[model samples]
Target: MNSVIDLLMNHRSIRKFKPEPLAPEQKKAILGAAQMASTSSNVQAYSIISVTDPLLKKELAEFAGNQAYVEQCGLFLVFCADLSRLRNVTENCGEIFHQNTESFLVASLDAALAAQNAAIAAESLGLGICYIGGIRNVPHKVSEALRLPELVYPVFGMCIGVPDQEPSLRPRLPMQAVVHENAYDTGAVLEGIQEYDETTRRYYRERTGGQTDLSWSRSMADKYRLPVRPHIKPFVESKGFKLD
Candidate 1:
């Protein structure tokens, strides 16, 4: 396979990092790669905040579900879905900005795309990276800590640095369970998942030294057994996303 496809296939989240920070030029190149990602309508509705302050990183670590990697990583970047810039541009042009759910979706997609590009670029450069979705666990506190303005919300955080540990790639759902032809085959989908669950169970058992007995569907069912991040809608609305 080509290098790019090989790199994509071998992707894994790196949690442990070496203490050394990335060089200035490396940071610049990674950010440039992120900026080159495709954005909807060329709005580029995203902003990245690189946190370097020790105290702030410590606080963010606590806020992000006590993930110590946040503070230990060589670089911590928070990707924000931002529409504030567009609002300001519209105001300067003597027009009102009316944002709806579509605007929010567009900005979110933009931020996700940009962050993925940055992650790929970092990985290509021999650096390891992990995406921190726990940053959304307490969105309000994160916004307050970061001093984010209205119409801008943190989508996720990323930790990047020299790798300190090697991890096996996580298994994904079978292609037949995910990809569909002209019409979705429900029967085939169910069978595929059932087959894939066995694969996931074996992986988990091996990874955990035979201490865990979990299948993919079982783990997912437990995760969604209760409501998750129910406060996100109100929090995003408060950030001026409206999402109406």
Candidate 2:
């Protein structure tokens, strides 16, 4: 109901950007906000790598499915779930390092929280932002390109810059589908899905000038009918994460 809520409601992925870099102060503010995000038990197990080199950004863009915005954005940040720092600290403190699935999840969630804060701070400064999850498609290649060490893996990337194009805000599922009162409501969820399908169908059609008529359910089915990113497990394990 306020400026914060208004900003949150208008959130959208910006794929096009103006060819201008952020000011030093703007970058500092955004990163400062990210560092303040909540962490699990003070284990701020995350690291951000700002890709400033043109060649490195180009390589990362390739690793992230050739997404041009990754190279075009004024600031490209690679958020990593970094347990290496924590492990080192623990070892130095004479405590045996112990990690499992729970620790891995905590680190990933920590990175995500920090990234969201950065996105909001950037948007508040009249900057457009987009999250590039496509980096996960070739996580190993991205890690190698970034020279990430063990216990540190790229969670995702973010593109931040001035907007060159305005895109429509994508519709989300109804509140009833996501929020439940006191307990899980299966019927409400199914109803919400059914309702969202119609909204998504109309969204794609209007967005594409009636050339596309796909529903959310159908698109999700197409995406999941095939095993999506089967290599993620092996890749994460290769990074020294103990999923068990």
Candidate 3:
């Protein structure tokens, strides 16, 4: 087994996948690893829907910003932040069922922890995985496709399979910028981001065959310049999360 640092440092998101299926044992082991992750108060307030149906996968692919990897990967799992189970139990026991801000945080954390463990497990087993954050583009459609009830929100999707291409390892920010001693320093943080922008621009030039001269900071600033991308406030509010 590789050391934790090696496994983490060597991580790369695999977008190209081969047409191969994981063995039953492999699937079980990956799921088991996810199940072993720490949960808030042992509530285990998350659920994973292993998508196998081709039709459903196609729909999910469209829902996730037209990411074809959803249909190409051998296993596409949707991680959900779920409070429905607890709510049901509470109601069944003749109690008031109220899910507030704290409950949402616990569910979200539980889902994120489990998904990370599953990603590591898949990587260890010689399988490639990529996280599909595009699921949030149309969260309600995703919930509908998966038949998720109220109080259960789709966190993200993971596509796991044998990789067809080995992409370069993406660069990361320097540790000095992120690791603070006792207090937070805003000036250091901004400087780190500026340095990282240059690094990312170099990486983009190398990877995309000089297609873009885009720097990370410029790209992010441009994104925020549009109102549509920032329109997620209403969508998230509709899902019952109060960012306040």
Candidate 4:
């Protein structure tokens, strides 16, 4: 296999990281790679904050579900879906900011794609990284911590550093399950998911010494079973994004 394809296929989320800081030159290269990612309409409606403040990292760790890796990693970047710049430009032109759901989704997607590019770049440099989706758990706290203004929102956070442990590659669903033809096929999708459960079950059992009895379906159901788990609608409203 080609080196790039091999690297991508061997992907695993790294949670434990070494304490050594990344070199300045290396940091620049990684960020440059991220900037190279395709942006919607070339608008590049995203901003990344390279966080190094110890106190702020601690607070963010807490806000992000006490994920220790967030504070432990050598570099922490909070990727934001920023519309504030455009908002200001429009205001200067005597126009009001139209904060709609579609705009929010677009900005969020832009931030995510950019972040993924950075993650891949970090991995290429032998650095380990993990994305903290818990950044969304307490959206207001995240915004306040980052000092984000209106029309800007924290989509997610990423940690980058050398690995402390070599984690096993997690199994993925089969290609047949995810690859759909011209028309969508739900039956193939369901069957693929079922096969994936068995694959994941074997993976979890082997990796954790048979400690975790998790299959994909059960684990997913457990997640959805929780109501009021980090209530977010009100937080999104506070961020000035009208969902409905």
Candidate 5:
């Protein structure tokens, strides 16, 4: 495989980190790479907030479901889906900025794309990184803590630092389950998942030293079994996103 494919394939979420800070140049390079990522309609509707204050990091760690890495890592970054800039720009041009579901989707997608590029860049630099989706667990509190303004919402956070541990790469679903030709094949999809479930079960068992007995489907079911972040809709609406 090519270097890019190899880098992508060997990716792992790093939770533990060394207590060292990234060099100033390294941070610049990574963030610069993030800015180089493709944006929707050249809007670049996103912003990255680096959290360095000890008290703020501690509070954010609590806000993000007590994920210690949020505070312990060398750097913690909050990626925001930002439409505030665009709103100001349009209003200054004497045009009403339409805040609709499509606009929100575009901003969110742009933020995600930029964050993925940053993640890949960090991995290439031999730094470990983990995404903290738990930032959404208490979205309102997080927004207040970060002082996020209207038309901007925290998408997720990332922890980057020197690796303290090496974990095995997690297994993904079989390709047949995800990819399709011109027409979709229901039978192939079902069969592929059934086969892939066993693979994931084995991976989970081995990874957790048999403490967890789970498969891909089972994990997904448990995750969706409850309403996760039911406050997200109201939170987004409060952020000036007309998600209707």
Candidate 6:
């Protein structure tokens, strides 16, 4: 309805980008917006790494499953959920730092919120952005490369640059399926799944020029059929996080 809404609705991941770097003021504004994202109890338990070194970007590109966009993008940022800073502050004050699954979840959510804000701000600046969850594929390596300390982990990475391509907006599930009125409605969700499956099937066909045609449900099933990132729990624990 409004310009902001239109901008939000039109968001799509950018896989290709121009070689130009962002303006200094543009980077500042995006980061300022991210820092203002809502945090849990003002904990502000997140950190961001701006990877500008060409060698480092190349390494991270490999770490992110060899995604060339990670290296090609003008700027690549790693958003981290960091409890280490809070622990240092608390213990330095002679108080025992309390940490558990709740704290972990809060930190992760904080990182996500800040990242979304950064994305919006970048988009508003006419910069295209894409989230790279593949950083988690080799979390420990990424941490070591970035010199992350204990109680800090990379939540995800982001690539930002001038857009070199215009991609079609991907469709989302019907609102009725995702939004329940006063309670959870199973029937509505199932109906939504059925409808979305067909929509996605057609989407894949058209996008791939009929080379691929798979329902959303089938794709999800295939994905979940195998274990995904089984190393995550162990890696997080190794970083001194107590999942208990």
Which of the two candidates, 3 or 5, achieves a greater lDDT against the reference? 5
Candidate 3 Cα errors over 4 Å, as ranges: 227-244
Give the residue spans of candidate 5 off by over 4 A. Answer: none
Model 4 regions lying over 4 Å from their true place: 227-230
> Candidate 6 on 152-215: residue-level lDDT in tens?
9999999999999999999899888999999999999999999999999999999999999999
Candidate 3 shows a clash count of: 0
In angstroms, give how far residue 7 of model 4 lies from its true place. 1.5
Candidate 2 residue 4 C-alpha distance from true site, Å: 0.6
> Tens digits of per-residue lDDT for model 4 on 153-221?
888899999999998888888887888889788899899999999999998999889998688989889
Query: Which run of 10 residues does model 3 get worst, by summed lDDT?
Result: 228-237
Task: Give the lDDT of residue 10 in candidate 6.
Answer: 95
- The whole-model lDDT of each prediction reads 0.95, 0.96, 0.87, 0.87, 0.93, 0.95
* Model 6 weakest lDDT span, ten residues long: 19-28
Alpha-carbon shift of residue 242 in model 1 (angstroms): 0.7
lDDT winner between candidates 4 and 6: 6
User: Which of 1 and 5 is the better model by TM-score?
Assistant: 1
lDDT of 6 at 157: 100
Q: 3 or 6: which has the higher TM-score?
A: 6
What is the overall TM-score of model 5 with all chains considered together? 0.97
Which is superior by TM-score, 1 or 4? 1
Count of residue pairs whose backbone atoms collide, per candidate: 0, 0, 0, 0, 0, 0
The alpha-carbon lDDT assigned to residue 208 of candidate 6 equals 98
How does candidate 1 fare on TM-score?
0.98
In model 2, the Cα lDDT at residue 32 comes to 98
